[model samples]
Target: FKNAGFYRTVRKNNQPNNNFKIEVIQGGLFSDEEIKKHPGIRHETTQETGIKHLDGTISMARNEPGTASTEFFICIGNQPELDFGGKRNADGQGFAAFGKVIKGMDVVRKIQQLPDENQYLKEPVRIISMNIR
Candidate 1:
């Protein structure tokens, strides 16, 4: 992963509205390329998943309809505008909701309360490791 960090609680006009996300680099960090060398998975919004951007919901981040890499986010509030047919983006194809926080919502809220500037955490919360048990 090229980047893995929590989003700032404050929102900027030009920033993508999200709570936290881990950016997965397509190519290794050493290569000086912005996009991936090989074509990655292009998940198009064929149909609505019927998932809403409610609090604690986890979803994939994508610029276009498809082209979702390993980047993802966790919502801290009821972001209904991020749903399909919502006006968050011009395309109207909102992010893909895949999961939610089943426990430890207090930790997520604490992370969201961190200090930040321009949607970037002033003192980033380091994640040593994430164990999925």
Candidate 2:
């Protein structure tokens, strides 16, 4: 629900052509222990829901397959590798995709561009509030 960190744009080797390169952009959420400690928090993984990680998709962040707590991430690009059976993780369960950005993608991109050292944002962005409609 808030900006915890951002993934720096890095050049990855093109699989088809070793000499070619592609940029991969990614980002992460700010975890709040207070939120995680809330009595209402659910530590379970819930159903798979068969969702895929497309651009702007919001998904729960987990260390293992079923350990997602309050952390989450928003896809800055089509991250099929983060979807179920994705290659991004060894377990291959992938992150739980739940929501998509309806607007303000520019703001998201701007935040993604913030300076980062070793993949950690130099200045972590904060979420003052969140509302559900």
Candidate 3:
């Protein structure tokens, strides 16, 4: 995901229908054009990885407990409602949290502040490139 991902959508505490202070920005090949560019990929949800959704947490974005894929999000604040048994989802299945932001939090926060309509960013942030040590 280092080079194949882009900052996609975002959810803040102000969004309607939200009951908790949830703030997250989802990322991946969301657009159809982008999805076609990166084809034949797989990510199994399996189960909810137990980890409190604190600031800077990175996790997989899924509709159901078994449908996780390449899409991921970064937590902005201590979003406990995203945890298992939380109110974010009705099924009690939380997101698949695997890591946290080691750096570039300033950049992440800036993404959250971008203009969005119904949680979708107006100008999607492009991932120039990335490398893992």
Candidate 4:
């Protein structure tokens, strides 16, 4: 997902009950066409890992247990609420955190500042290439 387009970017929580304030830039599930073209692939949700979704952290986005595949998000700030038992999801089974940004956080914040409508970016900021080390 190094070059995937960001689909969702939110500053805070406005949803009822699910008000676990968070800032994130989610990508991987682009558009309907993209979904149709590359149907969402499912893989086992790896658990028991004690990774936390801190600022610049990268984690998989899922609906439920074992529902994550390609969808992932970058936490704009320390998002402990996205860890195990987080209230953002009804299941409280937070996302599967895997990695983090070692540099270029300024770019991540810039992406967070991009105009968004109801949590979705008006115009996605896509990376042409990303180096992972």
- Compare the candidates by TM-score and give the number of the best one: 4
Task: Quantify all predictions' global Cα lDDT against the true fold.
Answer: 0.58, 0.58, 0.71, 0.75
- Highest lDDT, which number? 4
Residue pairs in candidate 4 whose N, alpha carbon or C atoms collide under 3 angstroms: none
lDDT of 3 by residue, 27-96 (tens): 8777666545543424322243456788998877777765666677889988777777677888776776
RMSD of candidate 2 to the truth, in angstroms, is 5.5
CA deviation > 4 Å runs, candidate 2: 1-47
Q: What is the TM-score of each candidate against the true structure?
A: 0.68, 0.69, 0.78, 0.81
Evaluate residue 9 in candidate 3 and report its C-alpha lDDT on the 0 to 100 scale: 50
- Compose the digit string of candidate 4's lDDT tens values, residues 105-132: 8988888888877788888777677666
Candidate 1 clashes between residue pairs 3 or more apart in a chain or in different chains: none
How many clashes does the backbone of model 2 have?
Answer: 1
lDDT (Cα, tens digit) per residue for candidate 1, span 104-131? 6687777766666765567665444444
* TM-score: the better of candidates 2 and 4: 4
Model 1 bad stretches (over 4 Å): 1-3, 10-40, 44-47, 131-133
Reference-based TM-score, model 4: 0.81
On lDDT, the stronger of 3 and 4 is: 4
| lDDT for model 1 | 0.58
lDDT of 2: 0.58
Regions of candidate 4 where Cα sits further than 4 Å from its true position: 13-17, 32-47
